[model samples]
Target chain A: MSKYVMKNLSDIEIIESVKRGNTADYTMIVDRYKDRAFNLLKRMLKNDMDAEEALQDSFLKAFRYLNQFREEASFSTWFYRIVYNTALSVIASKKRKIEKEMTSLEDMPELISYDREIYATVENPKDYLMRLIDKLPIKNALVLILYYIDGLSLNEISLVMDISLVNAKVLLHRSRNILRDLLLKHNYQEEIL
Target chain B: MNIDELLNDYIDGSINANKINELKELLEKDEMTAKKLKALKAIDVLMRTIDYEKAPRDFSEKFAAYLAKNRVIKKDRKDFVTPTVLSLFMVVMLCILAVSFYYSYLSINDTEMISGILLDIFNGVSFIAGNKLFHLLGASVSFIALTILYIMNETHRRFRKKIKDL
Candidate 1:
């Protein structure tokens, strides 16, 4: 099928076509997920090339194991799991520790003072917000990206991150609290509107 | 619920009218709580509205090219079936050879069917064991089988490496 026609087909339909030996149709799945999944990886890995490489590996894995995909599950959730795990493995390879092991909502860390001057370096408010998000722990960063950026639900985020739903919520709320603290310290309160 | 959860519920639009009125009452009286809510709301606005970063252009095309280049032959249970059946056949032949060797060398021949079977089996075993030409042929076949197995193993390992490398 042409890319234009393929664009309208559901992910499952595209998967079925690919399963029937229409390997060319896999581009739809790739194109559908590449950017959102890349955003997740890029935020977690903090590098474009690494994110791109991990994205490629993830797609290859998803294709290789496409037959193993369960029909009952959403392809976005399944593919995000691959992307999340791939990014984790990349971080593991680099020997960087994933921060914030706190699992409960009540386990939030004490608020620390943030440098207002640090937030002054970025003039674009969006980039500055992204920078604040980048400073979070890997899984915490991931939960935020998957939630706010990708618009995945907490349930789906939990599945992708292999954590409990409450844990996913905890990660998200904790990261948000941190980001808020940073913004407030930076005196962006009036400008946020 | 406490003020924080109430605030979250209010921000999420998950609160009932009763709780929302209660949060509003608390916001009027609570300055610290109000600041937290303000900051949290700002985060919600930015997080919801910010554009997601895009992957490089041509990502899908590059992936399609990579997929086309590496035509991955999926590993299936059927791939192992042939080897398993061949191994079973080889074991059966070895058992027949052992019986023939026992009958011809140990003098234990009894049944008419077995005696007839061993007569041909003895000839083939002796022919290979005694003649240099057949011996060379047997050695060459063994070498070729081992080489094939080795190459199969090496190919599997390299295919795995290639997948990981990319």
Candidate 2:
């Protein structure tokens, strides 16, 4: 079956199909999530090759143990858990810490508040924001991106990150504080109405 | 609490009208508070604008092949594990039964029978081990050792090649 035809199927329907011997439908699940999952894994691993390997490994592992998946949580959360864990294992094996460099004072922009409208009309807002977010610590970056960009709720974010709701909230709060501080330090403050 | 916390609470919409009024009052009074709110709003807007990374054009094709291969491996693993586990369980159960039978026989006052049975079993085992069976076991063990060494050597060579390629 064409993946586009399967695209309209809910996750449960696809899963049920795969379970009931329509094994090719598994590719639909993979196709549906590949980009979003790739982006997340890329951010987490911070290396394209590592992210690709981890993503592939995670998907394979998820398929291998699909029977163990409970319906209590959304498939995205469950699948993200697999990806998060797979990336972590690679990190652990590499024995290298994901370092967070404090943004240097020299790289700081001038201390004038840019008009909100002006910032909004910039050539590429998404690229601009991703660059700023990339400067934060991985923990903060992941939380902010997952919460704001990926549109995951606090509960889902906690599940995906294997953290408590309180921790997720705290991380989010701290990330915003850090981003704001970074902006202020760089004089990239936006004008408030 | 702190202004940052308050601002965050406000932006998250976790604050009620009273709290919102207080925040608005702070924003109106403190230029810094207003700027901070704007900075946060920018963050929100910018974040939502970010796009998901596009998967490679051939990702679906490659991933489907990977999944197909993975399924075969999974099937093989399942086939292997079930029989292996059943065999192990049977072996364990037989050992337990033999031990129980031995103990129950011991509970009897017949030390001679027990000794006779044990000697017979030992003789039978020794006869087998002393004959062609011993030679066959030695050959099999040596073969296994050679196979392991070959595998290890190949693995080491592959590892070195990989590092060199890198």
Candidate 3:
């Protein structure tokens, strides 16, 4: 059957299908969230090949342990948690330290000036924001993507990131400040806004 | 209370009218707070523009093939059924053994038979020790250990030689 037909099936149903030895049905789950998971891994690993491999590894892991899944949280949240930890392990094994560098206010310009022509010429603020997000520290980048791009609530983001809710909120707050500082440093604070 | 918290609440729309009034008062009181709010709001707008990547066209097909290959291995293992049957069989055998032993114990009303069986086991062990079978076992174990050491040394020597030749 086509994945579109299976799209209407709930996660519980898909999980049941896999449990019943309809292993092929698992492709539906892979098809649904591969891109979103890929993007998260890509951002975390900062490499295309590593992200793709992690994505595949995570899917296999989720399938292998599908019997342990409970309905306490949404499948998306649980699956995302697995993907997050897998990416974290990959980063850890490589001995990469993802430190958040707080930009000092001194790096910002003294005066904020705006011009109408600058705003008019900016084709896509979203695309511009993506580039800015890429420059952010890993932790801040993750929080921004989880909160804004993935549309996860604070509680969900906390679970996925395996941090406390207060920490998640603080991370989001810090991410905005960092992004703002970046804009200031680049002198796009007035024009982009 | 802080500018960051205030802007976050404002952006999330989590602020009530009282908090909104407090924020408004802060904005009017300080130009810096107002400018910060404007910049944060703009950043929030840009954040929404981030898009999701599309899965490769062959992702599902490729993954399905992998699952198929995995299923073949899973079928070959038969991990679930074999272990379950083995466990059940062992439990039944244990139960039978326990029941039979209990019945035999009950039938043996006299203590003489129990002492006789224990004495027979002791004599059998003594016989083995007297025949020097224990010495034979020790000698065999030593031989195996020496063989293992010799093989290890030879392997190491050959490995070094191979490396030197390379």
Candidate 4:
């Protein structure tokens, strides 16, 4: 893996390059982070088109405000924070705009495959597991995804999500319990034993 | 710890080895705890097995376009400061002019009144313009010093706003 892919350049380096108007350096940043950022946003938004749009918006916002990036954190971590917030904002706006429309899992093509696996594993299928996870509050879902799927440490998640480390740990715990209970209720027992 | 807390740490491999050993011992003694652990392990396996998809093919291209557009807008806004700085410079010049007039009024002899006034205005304008020019040049030289301070303050404000939004 490229050093840029595995480890981010120092925030100071990025800020210096940006200040010098070496915008091409930012392209290196984009190339390095776009995949992880896209995956994160895709999971958060649970929709391909929405995730794409939000990722674009987030990258634009990050670039526009690149000067504001402080040297207190790694560039990739800080950039992911922007991506997370942008995805949340996009999802919230979408929810408000389409209040009456039925939120079918199938509507989000990227999520459909996950829903299928979840459905295949549980007796209750669509009604129990998929719906349970889907109905989880956005913050809980985010915490779960960041902690579990992304393999980010609680401290890292806290920094990215701008929450206290204690809160991040608590949310991760609660989300796991919720998922466990939902899976149990759906009779996903075969996988358990 | 409780099963809920352990479950997250266990799945993430963050739980200490001591805790894991303790949990394993408890699972041996308590069937319900064992069942819960089993379920959690299964869920973790399934989650891991699921493929983590990448973004669409054109995502980088679209993102590049978006970044370019936003960069232009940001540059325009940053450049917009030149006019404001000029206005501030004018304000400081006016203040110096006023001060010079006041001092000249007290210092000038009666016979040299007209010449003194012209001299006062000329000296005041030169002093003010010269001071400001030197300050601006100094600012440009140590650009990182004041620029970092200003950017830090603005970034702080933005961070607070972002937290509030969350």
- Ten contiguous residues with the weakest lDDT in model 4 chain B: B70-79
Please state the interface RMSD for every predicted structure, separated by commas. 3.8, 5.6, 6.7, 4.6
Which CAPRI quality tier does the interface of model 2 achieve?
A: acceptable
Candidate 4: the clashing residue pairs are none
Output the better candidate (2/4) by lDDT: 2
Return the top candidate by DockQ.
Answer: 1
lDDT for position B72 in model 4: 55
Better of 1 and 3 by DockQ: 1
Pairs clashing in candidate 2? A111-A187
Which candidate do you rate higher for DockQ, 1 or 4? 1
Residue-level lDDT tens digits of model 2 in B66-166: 76675543331234786899999999999999999899876878888878989999998899888997889989999999999999989998996567445
Chain A (alone) TM-scores for all candidate structures? 0.89, 0.81, 0.82, 0.69
- Worst ten in a row by lDDT for model 2 chain B: B70-79
Q: Candidate 1's residue-wise lDDT over A116-183, tens digit each?
A: 44465777667777875675567767777888888898899999989998777767776676676666
State every prediction's TM-score relative to the real structure: 0.70, 0.66, 0.67, 0.59
- Among all candidates shown, the one with the greatest lDDT: 1
lDDT of 3 at A167: 89
lDDT of 4 by residue, B40-141 (tens): 776666554443457777766666676566555344235468689999999999999999989977786686787877899999878877897877877787
| DockQ values per model | 0.29, 0.26, 0.25, 0.21
Error of 3 at B35 (Å): 1.8
DockQ of 4: 0.21
Position A93, candidate 1: lDDT: 96
- For the second chain, the TM-scores of the candidates in order are 0.42, 0.42, 0.42, 0.35
